[model samples]
Target: MVSDGANNTMAFPRETVLKVASLARLQLTPEEVDLFATQLGATLDYVARLDELDVSNVEPMVHAIELTNVLRDDVLVPSLPRHDAVANAPKTDGKYFLVPAILES
Candidate 1:
């Protein structure tokens, strides 16, 4: 395990990477395993840097910035006539739109 002296976080091993890939149902080449091991290790090291910060006084917040809904007010509207709604469709049975079957038995 490769470790930076400043933090206790250890670099992810090839075995760990392979295990995670298996759990995630990924089929990775040998080169990809090594690449992912390095990348994942770097990501952990970067995140470990956060432990050095002084967040004791910082208050927890749901979002970094204030968020407000930008949606318009909801109001009841008249529905379009069935014929007009299906007029431009490639295939329709007057009451419902026809679509190709997407599932096989």
Candidate 2:
């Protein structure tokens, strides 16, 4: 059973699980459907318990912890010469690697 957030609990029906599976394009067996119905019901009950918590004094933020950029400064670096870069390629035209055409007109 799942809570209604008003001290009321209700069963999470199998029909709801089937409908969710259909909407998600999932093909679930009868056993799986029953399992999901129970699991989802428990999850909803947990969320309802969380809803009872008092968070009025808590500040709303995008994340639980402050985030700062951790990326290193970009620096230009020397790269492998073009000929050496394509030397190990299966097919090359000396200037560029040749790949099979994936599309045709």
Candidate 3:
């Protein structure tokens, strides 16, 4: 496991990046491979700097604001009627509405 505090002293290898791409089923060209190698390498370097922090007294916050499930009463509220729903539709058959075919058999 990576701790919140780690030194930015280690190098992330290209082999690890290739292995991870394989796991993700990504087909990377040589150019993309080299590009991602640099980007992922820089990202790992930034992640390593977090290791120097002493978070012993700091609370681990999941979000900047309080997160609590607020339940609401299940009650029927005013809603749009069927006529209003189809009011602006381009075309409709008296008892039903028609739409463009989504698929061909």
Per-candidate TM-scores read 0.43, 0.42, 0.46
Q: Give the range of the ten consecutive residues with the poorest summed lDDT in model 2.
A: 2-11
Look at candidate 3 and give me any clashing residue pairs.
5-51, 6-51
Candidate 3's C-alpha lDDT?
0.71
After aligning candidate 3 to the native by TM-score, how far in Å is the CA of 87 from where it should be?
21
**Tens digits of lDDT, candidate 3, 19-59:** 88899998888777666666666677668688899889998
Query: What does candidate 1's lDDT look like per residue over 1-105, in tens digits?
Result: 545433323388889989999999999999988777777787787777779999999977888786778687699888998899999889999888999897987
Candidate 1 Cα errors over 4 Å, as ranges = 1-10, 54-105
Worst 10 residues of 1 by lDDT: 1-10
lDDT over C-alpha atoms for residue 86 of model 2: 95
Candidate 2 wrongly placed segments (more than 4 Å): 1-10, 54-105
Q: In model 3, which runs have C-alpha deviations exceeding 4 angstroms?
A: 1-10, 22-25, 72-105
Model 1 gets an lDDT of: 0.81
Show the colliding residue pairs in model 2: none
User: Model 2 scores what on Cα lDDT?
Assistant: 0.78
